[model samples]
Target chain A: MAIIDSLKKISDTVWELPATYKEGMRVPARIIATEKLVREMDETVYQQISNVATLPGITRYALCMPDGHSGYGFPIGGVAAMDVGEGGVISPGGIGFDINCGMRLLTTNLTLDDVKPHLKEIVDLLFQRVPAGVGSHGFLKLSHSDFRDLVEQGARWCIEHDYGWNEDLELTEENGCIPGADASKISERAIERGYNQVGTLGSGNHYLEVQVARPEDVRDKDLAAKFGITIPNQIVVMFHCGSRGFGHQVATDYLQTFLKVMEPKYGIKILDRELACAPLDSPEGRDYFAAMKCGLNMSFANRQVILHRIREVFSEVFGRSAEDLGMRMVYDVAHNTAKLEKHSVDGKEKTLLVHRKGATRAFGPGHDEVAARYRDIGQPVIIGGSMETGSYLLVGTASGADTFFSTAHGSGRTMSRTKARKQWHGKQLQHDLEARGIYVRSTSWAGLAEEAGPAYKDIDEVIAATELAGISKPVARFTPIGNVKG
Target chain B: MPYQYLEDIGTADIAFEATGRNLPELFSEAADATMNVMIDNLGAIEPHDTRQIELSNDKIDMLLFDFLQDLIYFKDAERLLLRVRDAQIDKKEGKYFLKAEAAGETLDAARHHQRADVKAVTLHNFSVEKENGGWKATVLLDI
Candidate 1:
């Protein structure tokens, strides 16, 4: 309570903890949220974000987005930019275990009425086609070498292999493939763990859903139409997942490497073991960066393949070709990543390594990084909510530079998985949801119970904070009609 | 049961405490806690297969860390659900060494009532210590 009281309110939606709040901090820490959300935030988030402030090369402030919650070394929704030339370091904790763990949205011309009768059929087919749950493997079985190729080429490889449309790449962040990925940097064990996991909707909060946007839900009808939400009761498919075991292995392998040398060789002592990092210029850091890119690409390919599967299911259930149904990609956004980008620091533009763990990159309008087609409208930001509550589609704002152009990724969890499971029975919840017209399918009943809407913070409030802060603007809200939970 | 899931910590992940009378027992208990996060029914995992594990680390904590990571690796790589059996830990020349056997069957979703997927072991608040003349460990798993 004392810590919360100490926060200096900068605005109704922004609070700052001065550099003096903790010892060894190089910069202040900021939490972007309304007063109520800040009051309800877990205490660990403050400690974690403060710890992030102490990392070398952290510039401006260590920030937590509106959906901030307790995570490992960096709070979920944490954002920190390191001055690469000023002793900035790259930490695996800042990037997260599920590298490039992100969201992808696809728009279809079909309205709610057209999809209502076949919701269950479409969801069931997707559940089977897109592997889900623990130890689940994707349908794409690649050899060790081909798997290496896939990670390097990313979604481009999927297109070459006939898993996606050519346009899908243009709509993906970084064109679905980032540069500097080297398969040789990845460990053999990591390869073994990730090779068959290209298209899986891994368990523990990963999911695929069929959502609808009613006319009233479109807050900015013109903006929503520009991003493919043109039809009333428009049907859209969105899924949250990442590189699976491959990316986890990549982060694990690098974290252990960094921990071994962070203090001894690099002289970088971290407050928490999970915050292990190496200087951006160090051999260890460069190697991990290259390897992390592989993980990033792997996730792009994973989503690309999953999109192909979704198209197949929709076409099958509706007895029409995917193109005929107007299945076009809205956008794909990665929630966890570290990338080098130029931004204003001290009124001078400098290249900084921005780390967004459990946060989304929200580049504003006219930025070259925005896809060419979307340059005039800004980048699309997909924010996933709990399966039961629905999700939102937002656009980056010019004023988002306050946090280096980062925003909340999801409705951050408010309860632990065990507690949620104990409180909600998955079977009963499923039936209850079905009665409300939201058909549900999951790999495990217990996993379903853990994701009950009550376990998470209010998504609308989180979005409202972002808008007030001028970080991103909401275009439309989507209510789920069918879901495939992992 | 030697292990119990911790409710107050790791709101976004799974956390648990495992206790044992010795290092070997501590490692085994910790392994069970990790696997339990993925599969709810440990008894349902039959010993239809076996894996031998050998690892060593200068720090006792990392020794436990490496052993638990090996189990998760097998699960993701081969879909093998395992339980620790006959784990042996010894310290020589200030370095800790672990040797063990793990047994279970390849995961069959139809038979094994799966739970949340445990991504990896996080070092956040992860510890191995002596408590009340027994070895105790706490682990938080990224899910």
Candidate 2:
């Protein structure tokens, strides 16, 4: 394993490795982390990040978010931008298997006190109402035609089906849809795999949590007021999930196809097979992008349906209509994805393909891309911590634009899941969380054990690093009171 | 050979370790294990035509990923039942060059049982380490 020695500290939270550090690297690799966090990283992360720097047409810097971990080709919390017109490459590893796996936060009118007596019931309701665990299927089964429309329409399909509110679409990244999703490009196997899994929380680290809003952390007072979060101790529902099997199949299908086409037709030389790619303008690349968009849309639609199901459960359990109970979407954001955007490079505005594997877009206040409601306050960046810890809602800042308006997505794991299971017992961890008022329900005990608090870095420290790095500022803190794990 | 479940990282994860004398044998064993995680049997697929795949990577682990990806690609795209026939790996200055031959036949649902279509090889908990004898690799396939 190669070690990165003598990193030049750019600031209190930013560190840089110049391009001369490695041969064939087009840009420098920038790591956003504290000294302690940097030291804890496995050598593999360094190798992967450096390899990412060597990618074709990568611009400015190959950036590492605070939650960075050793990934296949690009580190999990990796960010890289390439000039689209200048022969940029699109690697599947950069987008990840889960595609648009992301976080959605919803605020409620009820306070923590109002739900104290029924916390367990609410948790049970969510666990039952939301399909979870491996191979879990939802009630929403769709035909090929319906699935194609869902991919083309995204959350708009859900809204049309009356699964979500129209306003919710406005608050979602890209208005809950990405254009140019060609269903024809997606393979039949990929479509079949996703047919019954849409709206299901297929297993592994995906979860739904019930949280209480902390009074001290509401930074956007006006926005909070507009969202009706005026009272302290208010309860909220936050969940993290994504495109599920559909995304995975699309990624798998395309990665192999890309590898086959990369050398023969495109004349591309790859540093890593896991970083299999094709030029963004190539037929293979365009097809993958279209397929990827389908995955993104499927996830958006899945989440919208899950949100509707949650609303139904809450209404049934609390004896109040969802509208009266204040079940409304605050915002939703995709953490693992690539988007075509305009950014200034060397004082010239250039269109680029920005891949954010485990990073979030944090467009600053007043950006036209931001929703009309949140344009004045910046985009809401949801950072989900481990189930046993607290999640934070942050707003994008001006400085974030320098890095294409992106920030760390979560706490990032400090220990591997295998290591965590070996070190701790799931049942014991469940007991401890319950003792702390966090009701835990999971389909698999072993899975729960792997996500123990110790497996992850402290989210507070990760958020603090982001704040100090001037990428995003904390808007609110939400401590989980109950959680459902798939 | 059978894959023994090592541990679970979360709800759907089950880690396993397998061993073989050579690259082809090791990949065959690993594929059997991955399929075992999803279904019951791999012995059902009939042996058929040999397919050749030549891949090169800067690192051995990536070569492993590509090797497995090729099998998945064949299974999904070509709808064939693939099993490793032969494999050779050469490494120099950190780069791994590989040539592999695999065999697969037409899938008969009555014999070959289809399980979850593995979506992609995940970076989550992916590893390839050299052991005292040959090479030991661990990967998490997103199913």
**For candidate 2, what is the DockQ?**
0.14
lDDT of 1 by residue, A3-70 (tens): 89879999999899999999999999999999989998989999999999999999999999999888
Q: Which lDDT tens digits does candidate 2 get at residues A1-486? A: 236574678888777878887788889898998887887776667777888898887999999988887766788788999888988988888898888998998988998899999999999988988977645567886887898889878999999999988888997888888888889988887776677776777656788999988788676676666555678989999998888767877887888788788889988776667688888988888889888999899889888889998899889989999999988888899988988998888889899999998899999888889889888878888999998789988888888866789999988887765567678877888998999989998876666776788788899889988998889988778889999987
Candidate 1 local Cα displacement, residue B129, angstroms = 0.4
CAPRI-wise, candidate 2 is incorrect
Q: Highest lDDT among the candidates is held by which one?
A: 1
Instruction: Return the TM-score for each candidate structure.
Output: 0.99, 0.85
Off by over 4 Å in 1: none
**Overall lDDT per candidate, in order of appearance:** 0.94, 0.79
Which run of 10 residues does model 1 chain A get worst, by summed lDDT? Answer: A1-10
lDDT of candidate model 1 versus the reference: 0.94
Residue A167, candidate 2: Cα error in Å is 1.0
Q: Candidate 2, which segments miss by more than 4 Å at Cα?
A: A1-4, A217-223, A226-228, B1-17, B21-28, B31-119, B122-143
Q: Compute the lDDT of residue A370 as modeled in candidate 1.
A: 99
